[model samples]
Target: MKKMKWALLMVVVLVLAACSTEQPGSKSSSDNEDAGKDGDKEFKIGLSVSTLNNPFFVTLSEGAKEQAKESGAKIIVVDAQDDASKQASDVEDLIQQGVDLLIINPTDSEAVVSAVESANNSNIPVITVDRSAEGGEVVSHIASDNKAGGVLAGEYLLELLGENAKVAELEGIAGSSAARDRGEGFNEAVDGKVDIVAKQTANFNRAEGLTVMENILQANPEITGVFAHNDEMALGALEAIQSAGKDIVVIGFDATDDAVKSVKDGKLAATIAQKPEEIGKKAMEAAVAVLNGEDVDADIPVDLELIKE
Candidate 1:
């Protein structure tokens, strides 16, 4: 009787141990499947931007994040700090990380082509924002009409000064498409009517704009108007004008909050507003469409508006 009782106890202990092992294993497998169903399966995207120092790009980043969260995709953002080589390296790292898509705001239009092409060869789609690559077949490009913004600035300046005023121009990055297009359009709109007294490249930086505008003021003190390619430069020019005790009319692009306030305070004349948020939202939406095997337009142009306080 004693031997039989011990055997029964041993059998019961072994059965309980076996049941415990199977239960945890089954639960773990189910948990892994749940992870996949919750869309946490490691879908990643790479976003390379020119700079995060600028408010415009900050807004763009926010918009992208909003859209990406809605689609359940993870985004890795890299700030190039306005350096082309750094941007290239960042993109390479993203490629190595096996990102599903690449979104770039090229610091230099032509410098980013090879990096984009590399991704293309690896079967990854590349999308451009604001700035474009010179010779690459990107999946999509989203931007505002920079040239039209410039033309609007030019026309507004001409109207303010009666089409025969002396004007100074503050240009952004020299080789950038935004700089070139805006300058060209402004020049065209005011062709043979207004005199462009000085045109200098401030590299789209505020401090540089202040120095450049000061030099222009010294060279041509009688200038009636100033046009800057971006709000940062425009604000700088405004400061220089105020410091020099000049009352020159100033107009800028990128209708940033500060720029709008300047206009309201009667310091700045007008500014063209580019919809950064809209650009960002649209880019993400386009990325989703591409992922879904749906066709998207090569160029998505966001509209611009001139804000005059």
Candidate 2:
């Protein structure tokens, strides 16, 4: 009888252990691991935008947010306001929120490395959109070919201006990959063919673009063409040129709404369309793939096109 009682107690203990392992709130190591799989728990994604002040970044954010809703995923977007330190702080806040994945559009490539490394330390996958981070592990990068877009702008400008055409370049923010790569490709295409009269950094702001272009115009009065790293600067430069009563062929990058309207109105010459919305959608898709533990391309390239009226 004693032996029977001992066996019954052991069985009861084993049953209780089994039940405890699968309690109402307990999750197994493999349970709800793949967010893309059916009936799994929803995944949370964090997006760090450089700045939403620009229409380009605003459209990009809209695309990502829309796709997140469609995919039944939660997304948190933080704007850096073009401040690198603010971006870093935003990323730390995202990390504290326990987001499953991170997508960053860096204000500066080098400044974003520490933020990326922080996500890496927490074992969270990262994807960079529009601009790149200079260091750390990233699951994927989604952007248009900035260098190729620059080359397109250069080639088109040369076609319009012909030989010996003097041009001024309005550069984007310093230490940004988009600025560097675009400048490289533009220089490669126009070197020895055209004279770049004045090149200045406008920090990708319209006000600064106008001020810098005003300065360049004052210094180099004979320039006939201009190539701005982005449309904001291009539009600003156009304003300065119009005010100075100069007829310069201004080519810009990123066909933002204002730039497109300017082109249509014959106020701006041309622009390279980076398709910021597509880039955002692609970044969101990559985030989902990373959360699903699926393999994704290291570099995802969106198509680019030149827009002119």
Candidate 3:
């Protein structure tokens, strides 16, 4: 009887040890499976924008957020309100958060380079949307072809003005990729063809556009047409033209709802329509691909449309 009891105790100890080791391994495998299915284990992205004040950027944000939700990834969105330093700080904060990917529409391309470098050092992939940083190897860049859109605007303006009219150009924020590229294309289209009497920068603001248009009008009273880099500035220029009692044809970009209505109402002539929602969707999709270790192109160009009424 003593031998039987000792044998039974030994059997029980062996059984318990076997159960303990098997249970932990099973649990670990189950946890790994759950992480894979839900993508909750190690996927996060960050999006930083110059400002949320513009409806265009707001739409972009909404699309990105929706896509991130569907992909089971966390996205941190930061708005810089057009402040370059704030944008840099926001990127730094996202980097510290250990994000797996970064998407940025920089306030100032040059100023955001260092912040992008910080993320690159951490092995995080960076994607630029709508705007680009000056010096960086971003995994992907998604935006409308601003230069092509500008050429379209110029050609449309020339057609509306009967091919020989004096025009004024209202530029966006200085030193921006959009501003430089769009101006280049516009000048190319209008070179030796039309009279660009005055050119000025409006910083892509409505009030500044109004003030700058007022100055241009003082210098060249016969300005028959106006070309603003964006619709907000175009609207401002329209207001200034109306206030000055001058009948001028105007063209703009980024056909916002207000700009579209203005075109319908005959207040503005035409605009180049860029699909902001599509831009947002593409950015998020590229981000997910990068997270999954898929290869993507460095530049993704969204097509632009010309809107006329």
lDDT of each: 0.89, 0.92, 0.87
84-111: candidate 2 lDDT, tens digit per residue: 9999999999999999999999999999
- Top of the candidates by TM-score: 3
Preferred candidate (TM-score higher): 2 or 3: 3
Clashing pairs in 1: none
Q: How far off is residue 139 in model 2, in Å?
A: 0.9
Q: For residues 159-246, could you state the per-residue lDDT of candidate 3 as single tens digits?
A: 8886668999999888678888788888888888899989999977788889999999999998899999988899999999999999
Off by over 4 Å in 2: 1-37
| Error at 277, model 3, angstroms | 0.9
What ranges in model 3 sit over 4 Å off?
A: 1-42
Q: Candidate 1's residue-wise lDDT over 88-117, tens digit each? A: 999999999999899998888888998999
Q: List ranges where model 1 is wrong by over 4 Å.
A: 1-42
The candidate 3 region of ten consecutive residues with least summed lDDT is 33-42
What lDDT does candidate 3 reach at residue 100? 83
